[model samples]
Target: MDLKDEFYSAVDAVHNNISFEATTANEISTFETSIRFLGGLLSAHDLSGDARLLAKARDVGDMLYKAFDTPERMPIPKWDFHAALDEGSVQGSPGQLLLAEMGSYSLDFTRLSLLTRDPKYHELAARITDLLYETQMTTKVPGLWPSHVGLTADSLDRGSDYTFGAEADSAYEYTAKMVALLGGQVGQYEEMYARSVDAAAKYLFYRPLNPGDEDILVSGTARSHAGSGAPWTETSAQHLSCFAGGMLALGGRLTGNKSHVDMGGKLARGCVWLYKGGPRGLLPEATMLVACPDAGDCAWERDIGVWHDALRRKYGTSKPVEDVIADNRLPQGWVNIYGGCYILRPEAIESVFVLYRVTGDRKLMDEAWEMWAAIDKATRTAMANSAVEDVNPPGGKRLRMSDSMESFWLSETLKYFYLLYSEPELMSLDEWVFNTEAHPLRRMLS
Candidate 1:
């Protein structure tokens, strides 16, 4: 099968099977809802030139615009991204990615607009991008916060107070990447994208989260640090893994920002140290090592294997890293429930691929295949099993599906999956990316 065909088949399985869209808002559906499924849909569309996925992405984007009806429609009164419209209105950081997601979708819509001359799609997308940029751009100390648009703008709105470092960083990365995606097509807007990312990196990226702290702290702000009242440290192995993976990509490929790469390496190394109980000052087993003071303190069993494997392989360990992971003496299942290890399987797989890409190692590929088998077996159930839910072995299951299933997850996850699996001759990095982004339908009708 051609690359496009294979991509389409996988995307179809995800779309028909996966419950949430790529930019899925758990219960709240107004945020960047269009881009939620765009990456996956775009991938499918690029492969088959099937208008269905393109139409679906456009339809969802249009629905979001209509639902918002106005800029007022986009903001939830309370700070909740997951709350249904009927449940309650929330304005907070959860939708930061939604804002960027919308930006990405709009950029794609712009492409469609240029290609097809569809003013409505093009105009709506531009408006959405403007609205999010206007609404989210902030001017606090650090500057730029991915604030959740308030639904009510009422006196009662308390707004979400805390933001993690990972989310904001991702938004920054997305902002730049999205712009770069279209800059070749639209010259002027590329600067806008560059400026936004530059601002984020300068103001938000360099600041210390846990000053004088043992673990290196990074905020996972869905927006800029200015938006989220307080910066929260992201301690979850999964969060770090994704963060490192993204930084590695952004720094290495996109902007050639070595600082981002260096920082990613630092964070990756720090995560390993923490996992190995190194840096004697701070205990690796401490649950609340950073801002996550209330999470599980023990090293997770199911995820530890994967996490340790990733860390070991990423750092180029000689023997199986699991030996050290196992020696850490973490309580069994400590990481399984609280840390959400299973949700990290794809991430671990991606990390292996990234390492392989950089180092040209075959062991990483072998490791990734092994990890994929575990994920396929344990998590791939037909109906409800589209997501990786935290399970307690024999019977217990965590019903709620976290944002881990979003498009970013799928995009990065499958990008690696296809890159590693597809024959090298069939893969051209630029062409592969283009297949996902450059389609006639993606251009709007002028």
Candidate 2:
């Protein structure tokens, strides 16, 4: 059958047979359900103007809303949907919750409210954002909340580790995007985003000690050090953290901050640099880099011996520096490959797509094309694309493939690649705001 026939058939199958209750898993992820399924249905409705999709989306929304029925009305990271529905039993929120899990529901929930004209959905989601804003400044680091936090009002400052990665990445991301999605009516999101970005620039972003001394920044973790009396930066980078580039660019344009847009460009280029310098022109899941003393004014280390010495010290290796260097065969600026696998992640391309839309720079498009080519070459299999077992393979040999494929390969990664080259006016940035999963929700603003 043709593509349009296949699309209609798939939608009909979902509308006729899909049921949230059919799953046998005891628990469900609030974040995953919201983005992958609810957001998908809503965006599909937005695109196809299908009332059936909206009905399906509303059913999922109602089921997910039960997750926020805790004592403090904070969402449980892992929700027991069966208990909530079958036994009328709901558990209290956990002592510590991931910021992303609690904070990432705004876009989907808010859009659900607007579409269904049900304020309850939006109200439940707004309460979470309200608590986040109230606690944003009072955290261990002012203006940015920690990766983990307590749900109760009394225990808001329960965790200290902070980063724009993993558990905390999308919280900051949603803040900026929410501003656009809500048409800037909510000033709190804009303020929260600006403060968090400012703090991140000062503490969480660092320049890598590369040969070119390129003016690019990568997001990293920070912790309060007792001896230094300040937060110390960890120069480890994650592919997941690459979304910060797009988040920064979108926020800058919405808030009219030129510097943020410029910084976004540099950060996007930094991810491209990682892809180009890797063993097979693909970024690993995680890597460590030698950090420059200053992010704004960085100079490359002149002594190659010093670079090797630093790596040895960082890894606490007893072997000779030369031997240490020979074992890893790391690229310049990279000290260690904490996670060498490539799991078909989409964050780098997500940033590239956003920056191209924001800047209209054709160079970003070229960079994106190179990234697509590398990924297609390295991951393609007979059945489908697989994850790379090692992005930094030894001996410059062929990359080893793992027999795994994540849903994001189709949901977010391929979507970004397609949108990168598609006409800009199709799902235009001004018209739609994407959730953390890259599902495009129609913007309410004119």
Q: What is the C-alpha lDDT of each candidate?
A: 0.40, 0.85
Q: Which 10-residue window of candidate 1 scores lowest in summed lDDT?
A: 278-287
Candidate 1's C-alpha lDDT?
0.40
User: What TM-score fits each model?
Assistant: 0.54, 0.95
Clashes of 2: 0
Q: Which parts of model 1 have CA positions greater than 4 angstroms off?
A: 2-33, 36-41, 51-62, 71-104, 128-137, 141-144, 150-170, 184-244, 262-341, 344-370, 373-415, 423-427, 432-446
Residue-wise C-alpha lDDT for candidate 2, range 306-394, written one tens digit per residue:
46767878767688766776778788778889899999999999999999999999998888999989999999999999999998777
Alpha-carbon RMSD of each model: 11.1, 2.1
Candidate 1: tens digits of C-alpha lDDT, residues 281-385: 111212322232322332233233444444454436765555533543333212222343334323334444444444455754665565455445554544433
In angstroms, the error of model 2 at 135 is: 1.0
